[model samples]
Target: MKQSSTMRLSRLVFLYAAARLAVVAGCAGAAVAGVRLFGLEVSLTWVLLVGVLAGIAVSLLALRRLRTRINDEIRIVDNRRQDPSKRPRP
Candidate 1:
């Protein structure tokens, strides 16, 4: 089955959004865990700094994945656009 350009773009957008949301939630959860395990003795600044770092790491990973996915999609679109016969018959 062939995919339309709009469909591919929509899928990429959804995947990107999901990845970002997951990363943010994961960072928040980790920060909460650190607080619970380390207690109040640890400074809030340190915990938040660590959490922010983790979030940045997660965003970087997601960015890489997004880049790969976008590249693949662009390749597919280019190939489809180049092959006229592959397009659906009206």
Candidate 2:
């Protein structure tokens, strides 16, 4: 069965957002653990900076997967737009 374009787009967006949130959370947790366990004197700003950098790194790594999914959805949408017969019947 074919999936709707909106459904595909929504799924991709949701996945991307979830991945980003996970990255940020993971980084923050790690930074907190380092400070607590190692007795490292770290400021909130340093922790946040590390988190942001880690988040960007994670996002970059995941970008290819996200791009592929997005591209596939876009291609499906474009094909549907070009072919009236493939469009949903109302």
Per-model tally of clashing residue pairs? 0, 0
Superposition error at 34 for model 1 (Å):
0.8
TM-score of 2: 0.74
**Candidate RMSDs in order:** 3.9, 2.3
Off by over 4 Å in 1: 41-53, 71-90
Mind giving the per-residue lDDT tens digits that candidate 2 earns over 1-90?
976797888889788888888877888778777777988888978887887788778776867679688888888888988999998789
Using all chains and alpha carbons, the TM-scores for the candidates as numbered come to: 0.59, 0.74
Q: What CA RMSD would candidate 2 show?
A: 2.3
lDDT for each residue of candidate 1 in 1-90, tens digit (9 for 90 to 100): 977886987789788877877887689678978798877676767777788788878877768969688778888788888999888788
Q: Which stretches of candidate 2 lie over 4 Å from their true place?
A: 82-86
Where does candidate 1 have its weakest 10-residue lDDT segment?
A: 38-47
Q: Cα lDDT of model 2 overall?
A: 0.81
Lowest summed lDDT window (length 10), candidate 2: 55-64
